[model samples]
Target: MREMTIGKNDAGQRLDKFLQKALPSLPPSLMHKYVRLKRIKCNGKRCQTSDRLTEGDVLSLYINDEFFQPVKEEEAFRRITPRLHILYEDDHILLCDKRPGMVVHEDDQGTLDTLINHIKAYLYEKGEWDPDKEQSFTPALCNRIDRYTGGIVMAAKTAEGLRVLNEKIRLHQVQKFYLCLVHGTPSPRQAVIQDTLLKDSKQNQVRVVKKNTPGARTASMSYKVLQSRGKLSLVECELFTGRTHQIRVQLSHRGWPLVGDTKYGTMERNRPYGMTHQALYSYKLHFSQEGDWGELSYLRGKTFQVEDVPFLPFFYNQPKN
Candidate 1:
C-alpha cells in the first residue's frame, strides 16, 4: 500500500488518468479492477471511473508483492582501455576526465566495460588496490557522468574521503560546473529553472511539470549562455538542486534541448552537425572541506579544463557530418 497527495497539476484530471501518471508500471486494467473492488481510495473514500481529482486529495493504492524486490548493487569493475584524462589525483581523491561511450558501472553480465572497472584495474596495477590485507585501498567514484556524456568525474581513495565528499555533495558545498552546446540560444542568456519531474519508467522518459504535480519532486538549476555557433549555442550550467535528469529536462522544457540529445531534441536540428548525445562536460569543481580549504589534501583550489573539444571538449568531438 502506498499513499500520495494530489497537487495542482493533477486537479480536475480523471482519477484513471492521474493513476496512470503516478504509477507508470501498473497496468490500466489492474488499476481499474482495484478501483472497482474498492481497493483504491481517494481521501479515504472509494473512487469511481468518473471521479475527478482535486488538489490536496489523498490517494491510497494497494500493489502486489512483485513490485518489491531487494536491489543488489554490482561491485565488480571491468578492465577497459584507460581513455580518460587524468586532471588531478592524490592519496585521498582522484579527478579524471571521463570519455564518452564509457559507462560508469556495469548492469548486466558479459556486457560492455565501465569506468569503475577500468579505475579498479588502474589502481590494482599501481599497487593501490589490495583486498587480501586490511591496508589494501580501493578507489570509489563519488559522482558519475552519463555513459554518453564525458566530463570530470570524481573518485575517493579512502573511506573517510568518500564519506566527506558525499557529505559535502549532499550539503551542496561542492560546486560543479558543466559546459554544454544547445540547439538554440536562450533569450535571457542566464536564468534559473525550477520545476517538478516525474519519470515514466515504462517509456524511460521524464515528464517536466511547470506547476505543482503529484508524485513529482522539485528540481532547479542555473544556466548561462556563453557563446553561439551558427545554430548552436554554448551554455554553462550550475546545478542548484541535483535531481535525476534535471539539466536535460529543464533545457528541453525551455525549447533549447542540448545538441546531439536525440531523446530530448529534434533529429532535424542535429542533422547538419551529425552528432549524437549532448555535448556537455563537467569541467570544474571547487569546495572547502572540514571548513578548512587549505587543510584539504585532495582537489582544493583546483580546476579541470579539457583543451581538446574546442569550446566543449566533452561533446562534439568532430564537427557535424
Candidate 2:
C-alpha cells in the first residue's frame, strides 16, 4: 500500500484522472479495477473513480509491493539506448539534444537516470564537474526541454554560473530559437501569439484561454516560415514568454500544428508517419551572463543531432569519412 497526499497543484482533478497523471505507466483499466475493489480509498473511505478530490485530501492506494522484474527484451534495448545527446560544453555551460519518446524526468519515479542524470554524467566524464557528494559541485540546466520536443539545452556548471544565468534569463538577455515542421503555413509569416494558459490538474491537460481565467498565465511566441517541403512547412520559432506547451498550444490554435504532434495536431495532418513526436528542434541559444559577461559577451550555440534518422538529413549534410 502506498500513501499519497493531495497537493494544491492536484486539487481539482477526478480521482481516476489524478491516478493516471500520477502513475503514467499503470494502465487505466487496472487503476479503475483498484478503485472498484476499494483498494484505492480517499481519506480512509471508498471513493468512486469519478469522485472529485480537493487539496489536503489524503489518498491510500493498496498495491502489490512486488519488485519490478525487467523483461529480457526491454532490458536489452534499455541497455543499448542512451538518452540525451550532448551538443556543446564548457566550464560554464553544457548543450544537449533532447530526444522524442523520452520523458525528461519522471515526477513520481524520481529516478537518477533521466536526461538530467546523463547530463551530469557527461559533465563528470569531461572532468569539468564532480558530482560526488564529497566534492562541492554546481547546479545544472538554466532551463529544461520537454521530452517530446527535440532541441538544444543549456546547463550551468557552477552555482555562481547558475545564479548569473538564471538572472539573465529572467531579464530577457537570453534568446531561444526552434525549428519546427508544421502542416500548414501560418497566414502571417511572422506574428506573435499572446494568450493565457490554465493547466487542468485532474486531466493532466492544459487549456489555452483568450481571456482571464483562474490560475492563468500569459504566454507569447513568434514564428516565421523557413522552408516548405511537400506538405510540411519548416518554420522558426522564438519565445518571448516561457510557458508549458507554449509552442504546441499556440501553433495548434492557429491550425498549423507541428508535424507528428498528435496531442495538438489533427489526425489528418499526422500522416506519412502517423502520430510521431513533433519534428521540432531547438536550434539556437544566445546568452549573456553577468559574471563572465566580459569574456563571453554572448554565447551562441547548436547541439549535435543523431544522423541515423532519415528525417534529419537536412541538418546533417557533411559525409563522415
Error of 1 at 172 (Å): 0.8
Task: Please write out the lDDT profile of model 2 over residues 1-321, one tens digit for every residue.
Answer: 777787644565688777775665567888889889988899999999899888789988887653112122221213323455667666666677666655555456544456666665555566665533311233457777777776666677755456566777888778888888787778788887788888777765666885778788998888998766566676888988888777888888878887778777877768755546777877777654434453234463422433333255542332322
In model 1, state the lDDT of residue 295: 22
Worst 10 residues of 2 by lDDT: 67-76
- Once superposed on the true structure, which residue ranges of model 1 sit more than 4 Å away at CA? 1-83, 108-112, 134-138, 210-212, 289-298, 310-321
Instruction: Say which candidate scores most in TM-score.
Output: 1
User: Candidates' TM-scores?
Assistant: 0.68, 0.64
Candidate 2 has what TM-score? 0.64
Candidate 1 lDDT tens digits, 1-321? 877777543566678876675555667889899999888899888889679877788888777745322234454543345545677777667788887777787654545477777777677667766543321134678998777777778887655567567777887778888888888778799988788898786676787865667778888889998877667788899987767666887898889898888888888887777676777777777774445433254555555665555345433343442
lDDT of all the models against the reference?
0.72, 0.67
